[model samples]
Target: MATFFGEVVSVYSRAVEEDEEEEEEGEEDAEIRREVQKQREVHLNWRSEIAESIESSSDKTFQCSDLVIAVGQNASGFLSAFVLSTGNWDVVGTVTLWNERTKGPSQVTNTQLPEESRCVLYRQAACPSVVICQCTYYVAEDQLFQWTEKVLGSIQRRGLRVLVLSDCSVAEYKTSECITASPSPFLRTLKTSEYRDALRCPLMEQPNILTGLPAAVLSHCQVHRIPAVVYQCYSDVACPDSLTMEAYRPALSCLSSKLGKVDYNPSTEVLRKVVRVSEAQSNLYT
Candidate 1:
């Protein structure tokens, strides 16, 4: 009878121990769930803050007094410096355009920089150093000329001196096909005497001038008097307007002092005026 009692006590003790272990495990699971929930909340809050910041930034205004614009190609560093230099000053619509590669070579847009040769040539007109790599480019002559006119026109409109740097290899250019093609745009735009002068400028006389893409670009710039310089694979080429990081902060401070902030006024006011006039005419007819 005593042995039977001892066996019952042992079984009861084991049951109690198992129950406690289960309880401990349940608590640990609950703690783990809490941690996961906390992390999720933090992540969501961070995302919300980022979204709000973006929305606020879009409507932000800045002072536009005493604006100094700098234009260039492949000069992200310079552009950033310029921005930092003019802190609190309105820098809306700065940094005109850079050569952005489209999805594929075959995809041509109205403003797509034509052949790789023409692309570098365009940059050379604006920037001092241009690097050309050997690559196949497909663009029609007329489109290329038209795009060139637009780019040059932008420079004239902005009244900004631009320096560009292109970094590509000399071996990449395909020049023979481009050289023989008629530059009819030049013929149309240039006066007879000016066209004669441009033709005399090294490009026509030099054999395989198109093969040396930088030389061709400089020759063209020479004809137009656009103040261009070309350098091959070298950053040592001096740009007087190179903005240093140290000077950037001070420049911004100066700009802030000179130009107070102003709100961006859209041309929608003109449309509003037109609508009001139309409404008045309709009321008179009524």
Candidate 2:
């Protein structure tokens, strides 16, 4: 009878131990669920905060002051130092560089940098900014000269201080902002459709000096008053103002030299128009 009693006691003990283990497991499961809930809340809050920031940023306005950009095929970007130098700008814009690979080549409307070359160019160039790409339609467009005129006319309407820089400035640039260290007088014209579009012009069967393509482009810039500056790739090569691959810079110094030093700041009110950012990109974590 005692042995039988001992067996019954052992069975009861085993049952109690099993029940304890199950309770412990249940508690562990509850703890895990709590942690998961906390993490989910955290992620949601983070997203909401980011969205709000982006939304509000669009309300910010550019107060078009002065702009300096490093124009290039691959490393095209606005220098941050230039931004700081020309702080409280009314507007800023950066072109999609030709050389860098686009990070998200699919999304088109949000950013305008090229698919093959995307270098956070606009991040530093934020403010009443628009992206232009030569690679996109330069090769496909017909009536290139006509199209270029339209684009430049549009840029002129914006009314901002525009300064273009070469791979390196060979001459000093004079502007409201700091002077360019190595100004390339050859690189003076704004990026326009005149030359690229003229290449497609049928007057010449091939691209050469004889086509009078250079004369046509020169006349276009002169009419538009867009200062054209060409760049030389290397020191060994002479900088040719006429070429397919080229750069552009400002000629404020030349203007001053011709007309004598005149501080345009007193008349700066002409470019003081302020424009707010679009509603969409304000809070984005650029």
Candidate 3:
């Protein structure tokens, strides 16, 4: 090809150039996705003794009879004040994972350090069959299924009964009546088909579905024929308060024997500390 001045000009195909750029970008995007997924993968870390027991066990799973899980601020606070304060429980394992909402280090170096951990497992010393999981971090939607599977899979399913306590905003509750007219902090129950025990509260109403980790655990239990129950507390408080924490008392009452001596009537001072800590955490702008 020659220009009007008899000088030849080399021509390049714009379409080919654009295609190469897109191909390179597509590969880069795929690599980014792979890295993100790897970071998001959930890992279950058990204590040395617990890991050894699991490995030596015939079933290769921890033998658990009662697994109680508290998911959210109010639920976890309730357990911290009433159940865990009993001083008969020991930290056994932890779940480590990273997500978009994760803050600070995701891997916990010391299981005893609760302040540094997001999800932790505690087992009763007197009754080893009973285990409690306190999860105070956000588990993204995509990670919920895997989180539930790994946590539940590690525990023996035979004769296992799971109890989950979770909290949601009162605004999320569906009702015809005014939400303020009804109780601000109340308990609604959901149970798997295999759970034949009497509920501590009314069943969750239709068209009002549950999401997040509690729902994920219940769904897994339902599918696996495991006896599981969830008590969801609807609270108006923006942060965890004593009232919201106390709303879960009835749910814990059903498992009183398994939980040992729980301080159902926690002292006012104890309650204040719980509420104060939550309020301090909530005070971001101040």
Candidate 4:
């Protein structure tokens, strides 16, 4: 090739041109991955009134004393059947997130009640400082740390106490005894050093560890020097059952005074309704 000034110029081979094109494509692929990660980021969406309140607050965060989180089917069902059934609580906010496992609405929808959403926040009218989060969504492993940070970051750390309720399979629990001899639907606790309160259940023994959102939350609290504890229920049932949900009753005994005196043991009708709803949702073969 020759320039307009008559100076000789060399033309690159097709191989070089193809290599340049490949480099450009790689850059484009990198940009796409970055955008996808941004989309998968965790987010907490508060109701209009709550948003305004937080904006008006001096700390720009929710003033919480006791933040109770119920994660998984049985744990959330326990809240639904016993505590939330009293109808003294109001939906204050929700968690909006997207990941590979999320199949429900990505954002809060007016058609569905807060309780029906994947992760919903509720506040007791009698005790505004006490908040309950019922999370039913599947939070992927990569997203757990982010989810914990976003959720706890929104609440004021001063005078904050966190309690996490979660359920797992009995098979996950480690014991030397026969599986049939071991108690099913039993509670085990894990707490941070900052947490000085007496636990209702026995501490989780060594050689056993926690994972998922509960572990993430506890780890965050431990590092931040926040008082937090998790009450994990190990159940044998593949589906949520009233017995499994009842296993968490003792865990909330300490919170009764703060949450107001409501019946911890809900009527059988309420239990049936809550269990039926969870069973319907989790029954893939039906």
In terms of lDDT, model 4 sits at 0.86
lDDT over C-alpha atoms for residue 281 of model 4: 78
Query: Which has the higher TM-score value, candidate number 1 or candidate number 3?
Result: 3
- Against the true structure, candidate 4 reaches a TM-score of 0.87
Instruction: Give Cα distance to truth, residue 183, candidate 3, Å.
Output: 1.5
Candidate 2 lDDT score at position 2: 40
* Cα lDDT, all candidates: 0.30, 0.30, 0.86, 0.86
lDDT ranking of the models: 4, 3, 2, 1
Pick the winner on lDDT between candidates 2 and 3.
3
Residues 138-245, candidate 4: write the lDDT tens digits.
898878988988889889999999999998988899977786765798999999999998889899987789989999999999999999999999998888899999
Q: TM-score per candidate, in order?
A: 0.25, 0.27, 0.87, 0.87
TM match of model 2 to true structure: 0.27
What is candidate 2's lDDT per residue for 1-286, written digit by digit as tens? 2464564356677789999999999999999988644332200011233234444654322322322233332112112221222324221122221112222222223223233332222322343342222111111122335423432333332333333333322222334433344233223232343223111111211221211222333445556654432222211122212221222212334223322332333222221111011111123575
Model 3 bad stretches (over 4 Å): 1-25, 108-115
Model 3 lowest lDDT segment of ten: 107-116
Write the residue-wise lDDT of candidate 3 on 176-251 in tens digits.
7777666779989899999998898989997788899999999999999999999999998878888889888887
